[model samples]
Target chain A: DVKVTQSSRYLVKRTGEKVFLECVQDMDHENMFWYRQDPGLGLRLIYFSYDVKMKEKGDIPEGYSVSREKKERFSLILESASTNQTSMYLCATPGAGGSYGYTFGSGTRLTVV
Target chain B: SQQGEEDPQALSIQEGENATMNCSYKTSINNLQWYRQNSGRGLVHLILIRSNEREKHSGRLRVTLDTSKKSSSLLITASRAADTASYFCAPESGSQGNLIFGKGTKLSVKP
Candidate 1:
């Protein structure tokens, strides 16, 4: 069974449209992270949530927001999707004891036209 | 800047050949780990080597760490086309469980 699953494997949106990418985990996790991967750029953290209703800004949080209302669900929102924002977005959840180096989702390839 | 940067951004090798990838870090670390990613899929954890250790092996993969030189290497023996993927080295850093990942080395193994 897949433990962490992203809502969409591929997504397409207009340049000014608002987009939402979802991640759901079945295992008990204390922390979650959102990252974007681009060619030649690797992975850059966009947001991280330590606990329910708590979140932190990562290295590149601009134009993106996150919501963690429940323990198992974390959502990444793009307020106004831009063409440059088109990239593969990944979500990771570490172990319950605060251990990292966790597994990543299959990733959502977002394309903002 | 404490992360490990992979060398030789891209590599091409034939099946049955051995592939080696190197990682150079900027600072001291307690441990280092390697990961592999297929084309568009998520990364899979490969191996983890502690600072005090010299080398570790699993299956056809071997990892070596030299803390004094702040460098690490991953060796994949008897490679196959299925082994074609991007390899990343992560050096554990600081207090939190922050793993720094640089641009990975993309490997292409031809059958």
Candidate 2:
């Protein structure tokens, strides 16, 4: 089975602290995405990368940034964490064989105080 | 704003009963997909139905799409307690494969 692994399952950070969330996929997919899921707003894409060293902003990329230094890994960065930035962060990649659908990793729930 | 909207924010049903959820979208889409997320977990892709396909099935799950109405429905037959989770519908933008997801329907199956 294809797997996307998130480095952290839960995190707590002080307001104004810099934070990093990491993800790695083993399927050799060309695409990776980062999203933040909130109660009523659903999952909003923060950023997505279709190739190493290339990234694109998504619908809700204002407070977040991403890096794809390697083909199998993508990272999300919060320059200065705030209360409103606390949410469940998800990482996903398209299934193998050029499918448009995705396989997601277990999420990282971040809590900023 | 998201492109899709789902009905019945929450639903509860007994095990072995069927559960249904609906989603509506505002614009043209290349395909519609259904996903399930367990509490505190990432989403799992359940099914995908292209705009041209009216219906599709996998295991006990059935999905129907109506392009004219810009809506779709997902049905889970003989649901189990394990099936309790939040279900989301995503419509892929015609140009890019990027998906806009709807607020999910949380379903609870009691044993």
Candidate 3:
């Protein structure tokens, strides 16, 4: 079975602190994504990487950045965490062209105090 | 901006009843997908319907797509308590290698 692993299940950070969320997938997928989910807004894409060392900004990339050092691993970085950044962060990988739906890692719920 | 919007923000049903959710999108898409997310967990793919296809079924789940209307629907038959979760629909942005998901419909199936 395809497996996507998230490094942390829950995290708490102080305001203005830097934060990192990690995700690794064993399927050797070519696409990786980071999204933040909120109550009424749903999942907003923060960043996406189509290949190692290549990243693209998504709709809500203002507060987030992504790094894909290896094909199996993608990381989301919050340069400076804020109270409004508290939300459930999800990592996902989809088949080429997204012909198959995405496989998401168990999300990381981050709370900025 | 959100590419899709799901209707009926929440639904409550009893076991053995059917649950239906709708999704509408703004622009053209290559495909539409349905996913289920248990509380505090990541999403699990349920079904995918291509742009050309009208409807598709898998086991107890059925999905329909209407490109003309840029809308889709997901129906889960014979619901069970385990089916209680938030269901979301996503449309694949053409050639972007990403999916745009909408606010989901929270379903509660009472056993």
The per-candidate TM-score of the B chain, in the order shown, comes to 0.97, 0.96, 0.95
Q: What would the per-residue lDDT of candidate 1 be over residues B1-111, giving only the tens digit for each residue?
A: 256899979999999999999999988787888989999987777888888899999999999998889999999999999999999998877766666678999999999
Candidate 2's C-alpha runs over 4 A off are A97-100
Q: For candidate 1, give the lDDT of residue B19.
A: 99
Candidate 3 true-interface contact recovery: 0.80
True contacts kept of each: 0.46, 0.73, 0.80
Model 2 C-alpha lDDT per residue in residues B1-111, reported as the tens digit of each score:
246788889999999999999999988888888999999999999998988899999999999999999999999999999999999998886555777777899999999
Put down candidate 3 lDDT per residue, A22-101, tens digits, no spaces: 99999898889998999989999999998999999998898788889999999999999999999999999885444458
A40-112 per-residue lDDT for model 2 (tens digits):
8899889999899999998889878898989999999999999999999999987763333789999999999
Estimate the TM-score of every prediction.
0.93, 0.95, 0.95
lDDT of 1 by residue, A38-112 (tens): 999987888988889999888889999999999889999999999999999989876443223577899999999
User: What interface root-mean-square deviation (Å) does model 2 yield?
Assistant: 1.7
Q: Which is the leading candidate under DockQ?
A: 3
Best by lDDT: 2
* Arranged by TM-score, best first: 2, 3, 1
Candidate 2, which CAPRI tier?
medium
Lowest summed lDDT across 10 adjacent residues in model 1 chain B is found at B92-101
Error of 1 at A16 (Å): 1.7
